[model samples]
Target: MKKKIGLYFGTFNPIHVGHLIIANHMVEFSDLEEVWFVVTPHNPFKKKSTLLDDYHRYDMVYEATKEYPKLKPSNIEFKLPQPNYTINTLVHLEEKYPNKYDFALIMGRDNLKSLHKWKNYEVILENYSIYVYPRITEVENIAVLKNHPKIVEVDAPIMEISSTFIRKQIKAGKNIKPLLPLTVWEYLDKMNFYR
Candidate 1:
């Protein structure tokens, strides 16, 4: 049987409990063998000034996932071309892994609203599956995604926490241990990051 790997693509400025909860829930309930945290170097929608260095974000994900064997960290975007598009990454994964594994893009319902604006999104809709978890957003725009064979709604909790919030907390010198993993918090402190 081909291994089903769900690609949880994100910048992961700092890997936190919410991310772990969602990934773990998806792996157990969504028939995914593993969920890889694909650290995006630069997201088109995000401002670069607010984002951390790509390697720093990647290493944080790496350390945070050490205890969860089913959770893997991937810096695949670093090797790819600039302005890493989801379609391009998926196509490359298809070529690299071939019949060995099957990949599904895991995202939030929030992303579904902007799916149409992405590069070659039509191809992604037709070729691969998408797993979407609920988020506090208007979903009327994604009507086409509703009940689609290739689209699965993940029954996972929607954590309101975000990287922006975490970064702000760190800058304020507020204790954020309850928000993230211990290893990730310690790693951030060691690097003297955000403050």
Candidate 2:
């Protein structure tokens, strides 16, 4: 049997409780054997200026996930070319691993609406499965994905937390402790990150 692995791709500017929650639930509640946090050095859709260094973000993800055996981080994109795109990452991973594992792209519900805009979006849909978790807001046109055989809408906790929000709160000297993992928060505090 092919091992089922879900790719939870994100920049993870600073991995927080919300990200961990979603990833943990993705493994526990879904068919995924494990969920890997694919830390992209640069996301095409988001502005690059606001992103923290890739190594910093990767370290934080590693720090946050240290307690969860099934949850892990991947710096695969760091080895790839700049401005990493999901379709390219998937293609390379498939080629490298071949039949070793079944790779599925895990995404947030909001991404569904802009799926077409991603590079080679159709190829991604055809070749690999996609598992979407609900966001704080209702997913746009979720009913339209009902007929997609490879796309699955998973039941996950709707989290209001976001790295951007946390960053802003930190800059304002607000306490974001509640939204962050203790280890992650401690690491950020020690490093004086996001100041």
Candidate 3:
């Protein structure tokens, strides 16, 4: 049987409980054999100023996912150029891990709203499957992409938590234990991150 891997790519400035929750749920409910947290070196659409150093972010992810064997922290994008685009990463994975694993792009509904603006958007829609979870925004525009053969709308638990919120709490010296995994909180506290 072929392995089905879901690539859950994000900046993950600091991994949190919500991210882990989603990954666990994806594996429990979906056909995915494993979910790799493909840490993007830089997100083209997001501002660079708010991002933590790539190594720090990668370490935080590693710490957060250590307990979950199915959740992997991948630095595949680290070796790629800056301002990494999703299509390029997907293509690279396909070529590098050919036939060994079938892949899908897992993202939130918020990302789907801007999918058309991405580089080689059409090619992505034509080639890879997209598994979308609900975000703060409703899936209003999703009807536009429903016709795409590779699209799969998944109803996963939606957590209102965000990295920005967690960062703000840390900067304010507020406790973020409720928002993040215990291990990640410990790592952040020990490193004095966001202070």
lDDT of 1: 0.89
Residue by residue across 1-195, what tens digits does model 3's lDDT show?
Answer: 769899999999788888998888888898988999998878877889998899889988998888889989999999888878888888889889888998888989888888999999988888788888888767666677866678777789988988988999889989779888887888888888898
Candidate 1: which stretches are off by over 4 Å? none
By TM-score, the better pick of 1 and 2 is 1
What are the candidates' C-alpha RMSDs?
1.1, 1.3, 1.2
lDDT of each: 0.89, 0.89, 0.86
Provide the lowest-lDDT 10-residue window in model 2.
138-147
2 or 3, greater by lDDT: 2
Give per-residue CA lDDT, model 2, range 135-188, as digits (tens): 877755756566799898899999988899999999899999988888888888
lDDT of 1 by residue, 137-194 (tens): 6377467877888998888998888888999999999998899888899989999988
Specify the poorest-scoring 10-residue window by lDDT in model 1.
136-145
User: Candidate 3: what lDDT?
Assistant: 0.86
